[model samples]
Target: MASTLKAVGRNVLFGLLMAAAFPIALAAQPSHPSQKVTVLKVNNGQEVLVEINGEGRAVRLACIQAPLEQQQPWANQARTALSNALPQGSVVEMELRARDVYGRVVARLLKEKIDIASPLISRGHVFAYDGYLGRCDDLNYPRLERQAQRSKAGLWAVEGGVSRPWDLIEASGRQTQP
Candidate 1:
């Protein structure tokens, strides 16, 4: 009985130590800080050059894939839509995610507290990027895409939506994720 009581006391002490250390460990870890950035240019439907912390950074919109330049009219339309949404000099909150191989910051952008990708996806200007949707609302994005298809909005106005940018990239022998 004494040995059991000693073991229980050790376990409780260990638990208290871990509980106290956890917050300290979390505080030491680097955090992704959201910053207000000014839009410098819209590179495409899903990418923008923005000025953040006084440096110009290229940021790709997370969780949505836009029509590629080679996709013609749809591509231009998507770009125009994005440009309208984030015109030069407009400020947006940028939530940084991962950086891509091309040195672009993959991020979610918000204006007026509304997620920019949500509107773009709902409008059918872009598709819900399936493979690279970590930390995004995967279910809602696809649902919005489906709704756009049903309503025949933007790219979905055609019999079938434009070919996915990834598909075209693959056909062109590029293995990079867009």
Candidate 2:
């Protein structure tokens, strides 16, 4: 009981710190035209390190959420899928949406005009992020996710898909305030 209380306190403190440190408002507007950028590395399923203007930047893929590392094979598989899609040194078009609290660019990535998040959602490698769909194609993403769920693809192949990343974080005594 004492440990649980401590965990809760830590989570609350962390949330307060995050909220105070990054208070920038995110605009729910369409992103700017695509800008060519080189992929530096795949950070996870929904994020990557890229080079823009000869400077390194972290980009969070908009409209999707993938398994967290603690979720094991699914997380690794999601990361691998993203890595395959955006291999190191590969140049892609990035449509900038907004900067996230962590200072990562939240954007939609495209290769040959193909929206990368589409395939990931359709394959069930990631969940259509419902929380922040204001800047995305709200309808299309959820539709793709539903189709993937119906077909039991990728992470959804199990009896039920793995716990959502945010839920997993919450279960671990962490707060996902974004």
Alpha carbon lDDT at 57, candidate 2: 95
User: For model 2, how does the per-residue alpha-carbon lDDT over 35-92 read when each residue is reduced to its tens digit?
Assistant: 9999999999999999999999999998789888878899898898999999899999
Candidate 1 residue-wise lDDT, 1-178, digit = tens? 9999999999999999999999999987546568899999999999999997799999998888999887889889889989999989999999887788888899888898888888888888998985674656433788898999999888998886778888899889977648
Error of 2 at 114 (Å): 0.5
Q: After best superposition, candidate 2 residue 160: deviation in angstroms?
A: 2.2
Worst 10 residues of 2 by lDDT: 22-31
Best-fitting candidate, scored by lDDT: 1
Query: lDDT score, residue 118, model 1?
Result: 83
Q: Estimate each model's TM-score.
A: 0.78, 0.77
lDDT of 2 at 138: 38
